[model samples]
Target chain A: MQIIIVVLLSILTILIIGLLLWKWRVRRQFRKEEQKRRLRELELTAIRSQMNPHFLFNSLNSVQNLVQQNKGREAHLYLSDFAGLIRKVLNNSEKEEVSLAEELELIRQYLNLEKLRFDFEFEVLVDETIDAHNTQVPSLLLQPFVENAIVHGLQNKRGEKHLKIDVMKKDAFVLITITDNGIGRKAAKEIQQQKNGKGTKLMKERLNILQQKQGEKYKLTTTDLEEGTLVEIVLPEEK
Target chain B: MQIKSIIVDDEKHGRENLAGLLESHCPEVILVGLANSVKSAIQLIKNEKPQLVFLDIEMPGENGFQLLEHFADINFEVIFVTAYDNYAIKAIRFSAADYILKPINFNELKTAVEKVTKRIQKKEENRQIRELNRNILQPDNPRIGLPTNDRIEFVEVKKIVHCKGESNYTHIYLHEKKHLLVAKTLVEFEDLLKEYSFVRTHKSHLVNLKHVVAYSKTDGGTLELSNSDKIFISRRRKDEVLQMLKTSIA
Candidate 1:
């Protein structure tokens, strides 16, 4: 009976040891996942930070050009609006995600800022069917796409320059389309091949991080259409 | 009490925001003509002869520092505006220069305006030698100035080794034996040195190209100074520094 008791005790000890090892393995996995999340957050923040200054520098250049040409009053109005918009961006940087309504407001502000630089040449279209309040997006996500449209698409185009932005919801996903009547596919391919433009490269990086964090829930793509170029972003509806 | 001011920025918004702030807070500021580019700023300086300028550090083709290069003579005070925080800002502060961060804070704006006012007031009492010395430094130039215990010394283009930002003061290492302490911060020195051959290798260190003895590829990278000091190059600046080094060597 004593021998039987000893064997039972050994079996119990083995089970306990096995359980502890399993627990440790689970905890290690959890820690690694947390670390990855933190790294992604840092990268997203870095990308978002780059967007504002990039746009600011370019916009300021446009304003400077206008002022040198003696358009002081217009420059004043443009600057006032730009300041207001930038203040919004700075305030929003503290939050991880912003409401679709807030994002739209930011986009409107950005469009207005760009309007100052482009004068009457720049135009934006927002589809009224989409309810922006129900959705959420990464802050400053839409602006870069719009900016890319302007920089790569509309800036050097020969004919009428127009930027068309469409926001629509389908099932559980929110789709944002920005199309610019600028240069054709050849120019875009050429520009990308040059690898000199920092803006396009930055935009891709931000989109990649957004996809990684959300886990294949966000899709961003660029395609050259007959009118100009089409840039589309589809994001999952926040639960 | 009239602060003679000119707007020196390429952005319409930057110029307007500054103008708006001056109009609202410092009403005594005489609105001088605005300049968009370095060339224009130079022309405006010659023509308008404004005593103060609201300058933006970055422009499209030529940045604000290049504006100083255009002028053989300078007789003005500058308040820099920038969107991003960089080592350059520390350099500018180290030089006793005034600058405001973008999305301009009202309180900071008020302080900068006040500082410009005080400088204008003190300008008359300062000696001609000091004025000439400053002219040699160029009022609109963004090069870092070293400040000693008693007086602020403007560093000539080639004599600087590197600058390390230590708390409130910037420790400027010179090619010569005597290192100086600038009352300004590192961010200020960075701004002042934006146009020079200096680049921020690390958050705390800004190195002059003339003093980089050798560069060693390690963790991120490392630069060996003339004094055999190993300065760690930041990952963000590695590509930029390498490109700059290549150009300089070429």
Candidate 2:
């Protein structure tokens, strides 16, 4: 009986050791995988930043044309705005989060410069209920959508082309809506160059990464208005 | 031969501006007529049948796009005059239609006139207009106008099974045992085809989710397509590929 009890104790000790060893290996593997995943996300972010073509060159081209046409004052006015936008973009780097006000200012600068060149009318409306100062979002998140609205929706419009952007707070979410009375997605797809899809795809992945990090919902929807297009971006409201 | 052209814009200033630009810059383009409204423009187009029309969008009652729908046999090519509106440019781009931006620059105007003439010389009839009309009327699953070295080929977006990158070019493999070598990069196809159930499964390949038959996760992952072609999915895009495949099936 003594021998049998000793043998049983030995078996139990081995089993405990085995179980601990197994658990340790699993945790180590999981950590390694997590490290790899984080690295990949960082890599993706760099690629996205690189993929954004230089809109500055085109704006400068317009400015150059203005200067050549002897519209010195007009060129000067637009150049200041363009310079501000470039500075904001450079300043926007290295930060993970930015205030809604700062983001809007950047967008405003972009739109202003574009308006100077393209002559499209625009309005940026922030709802009175929400505090724009305290709200924080992923830096450069909304710019791509705005760019899409301009490139795909408003660029082809005739008459006095009007653009309306509304930022409001819904329950637990901040809603951003950009509307333009221009051609819709259907038309954009038809003349779609090869580079267009890849840009948006990268843009979507970036938004997904932000959503995953915040453990909140991120939704983007593009709807066609009768004469234009409306794009809505829903981001989680978190401190 | 001098190309007879007409200017159509509700704004009297728009018609006058384009007419003046053509007169000054593009000596080869003669402004034959000018109309302020679609109703008058339609009558004028029928009467004059000018080789080209500088069409303006967003008039009082009917827009510029509505003008094309009026005629069954549109003979003239349209050079769209637009502002900074995005949708119109995209649609115009999608239709492979031609247009110039607002505050039109002189160089762009000269280029447009030159390009229209060259295009006319290349083909007697403007097939691009018909193609554009078809694309506008049917928005989804469009025949994407791909301009190859020789001619423009409109391929249905869904029929494409997969695309493989060959350095600077892309090989578009169709379902019916056919392939097209396009001068564009795979990145370009990714931009256009991603909306049509295509995902970048590998660095060198963009596969249509609709074509995926099986996905094997073990041994660095492999997907079996409906075309009997097996593709490698990188570990980086594995999760996204799975999610897209799941959603596509559902």
What overall lDDT goes with each candidate model? 0.69, 0.76
Model 2 chain A: ten consecutive residues of lowest lDDT: A43-52
lDDT of 1 by residue, A1-239 (tens): 99999999999999999999999999987875875576456546544654557678987887787799999666655665577576656656664455566676777767776766554254445556654543446666776677767666666666677877777766767788887777855786586675433555565665665555444466778888887888888876533
Tens-place lDDT per residue, model 2, A1-239, is: 99999999999999999999999999987865775476456544633553345676778888899999999657755776676565556545655555677778878988887776567889999988765644556676667777777776777766868788999988878899988887778887677754553555665776776555445678988788898888888877542
Residue-level lDDT of model 2, residues B71-179, one tens digit each, is: 9998888899986455666567655567886566666778888878987776667666787778778877688766567766778878888988765567888897788
* Clash number by candidate, in order: 24, 21
Worst 10 residues of 2 chain B by lDDT: B84-93
Task: Give the Å error, residue B66, model 2.
Answer: 1.6
Give me the runs in candidate 1 sitting further than 4 Å from their true place.
Answer: A1-54, A115-123, A191-193, A196-216, B1-250
